[model samples]
Target: MTLNAETMARFAQVYRDNRGAVYAYLYGRAPEHDLAEDLTSETFVRALRAFDAYVAGDRPIRAWLFTIARNLVTDEMKSARRRRQTPLPDMLDESRFVVAEPDPAELVSAGHARDSIRSSLARLGGDQARCLVLRFFEERSIGETSTVMRRSPGAIKALQHRGIDSLRALITTGAIAP
Candidate 1:
């Protein structure tokens, strides 16, 4: 794949448009912000290198990029386990603390609602969580998600329905902290 001006321009456009969403998705899964940012950069770099070979077909570019992102996160999780590393909640970093910034606790509380959803989805396990993430966060349609997940549309629908039910139960039962 030639790194021509036109090609580079298109990739740049994609990066500008989707970087935030990609980072948000990664930040939710990756244990740390730095790791999330790094994974986000790697995602785009991988996407660019593979861009020439990428065929959109019925799936949008976002879904393809997310597939790459998901795989990277999975690899990172496995590597973490191999290293026997566990993520501690946000560590005390006095230097990075800024007065103007909202309190970390407050910010976390603000996201409590979102966190519960993610926590519950995670509790639902791998296939269901992946289906929900691709369907909801990446805004992929059922057909697109099926293509990305390599599942039948009917399977995707079943998974989605079951995931939603489990998530509702988790939240309603106070299984995940609000």
Candidate 2:
């Protein structure tokens, strides 16, 4: 399909609006924040190039962008497995010492909660983690998640249930704190 100025502008607007949510979703899964940001940029670039193929839907642009990002993450995971790369947890821990601007007290508390969720997510299998991210962090509806995940609503529900269960177990085990 031919690229046009209007289409490009719309894609840019959509990317700007959804980029933070996409980054959060990626950061939830990626071992390193830099890698997550890199993948998020790549995802938007890919989405811009593929904008003509995007369909308008009841779900927001973030859901569509997430589907694409999820696919990329899956491919990366497959490649990592084939290459026998270092485990995700080890990689995550290696990057945990980065410095960021100081947060306020409430922000620090919220950050702690997010860190707990991230730690629990890291323990989940890829599909489960993706499902949870889409459902919770992305705040997508069940139907939207089913579309992004390419699963039946029932299946997505089951995964959501099991994923939450796993997360709760982690919280109880102190792998993550509430």
Candidate 3:
């Protein structure tokens, strides 16, 4: 589709507004910065290609961008799992390379905390977990999250409340660190 100058300007504005949220959403799911960056870029590329088909009043722009990011991350995860099924050659064994590792006990501890939170999040219902991530981690408002999840604002609020309660319970039970 040929994007007019005005259409291109609108796309640029949307990108500027939502880029950080998209990147954060991907990072929350992917963990690796480089992988998240790649996914975020791919998400925008796809969005740009399909921009002509996008209806302005159909949904919030933030929601549309996030949907794109979520789909890319899901696809990337599936691709990674498929790649894992193939075994590496014995000659390229990582154990053969005696690389000096840095002593970062503090960093390891922080990572453990993140892992614990992720594990706790996994135990929540899909809707609840997603609401929590978009609301808290990505710092999206209730209205914005509702649009992304395709739920009403009230439903999003309820999910966020339940998700927070569950996270607190997990922390209290030592499933995750405070």
Taking all chains together, each candidate's TM-score versus the true structure is: 0.62, 0.55, 0.72
Q: Give the TM-score of candidate 1.
A: 0.62
User: What lDDT tens digits, residue by residue, belong to model 3 across residues 67-106?
Assistant: 8888888988988887855656777768879988877998
Q: Report every candidate's CA lDDT.
A: 0.83, 0.79, 0.83
Task: For model 1, state the Cα shift of residue 177 in Å.
Answer: 18
Question: What's the C-alpha lDDT at position 129 in model 1?
Answer: 79
lDDT score at residue 94, model 1, on the 0-100 scale: 73
Candidate order by lDDT, highest to lowest? Answer: 1, 3, 2
Q: Which of the predicted structures, 1 or 2, would earn the higher lDDT when compared with the native?
A: 1
Local lDDT at 88 for model 1: 83
Query: Model 2 reaches what TM-score against the true structure?
Result: 0.55
Residue-wise C-alpha lDDT for candidate 2, range 110-156, written one tens digit per residue: 77777887877887658788898788777677998898889999999
Error of 3 at 69 (Å): 1.6
What is the lDDT, from 0 to 100, of the residue 63 in candidate 1?
Answer: 70
How many clashing pairs per prediction, in order? 0, 0, 0
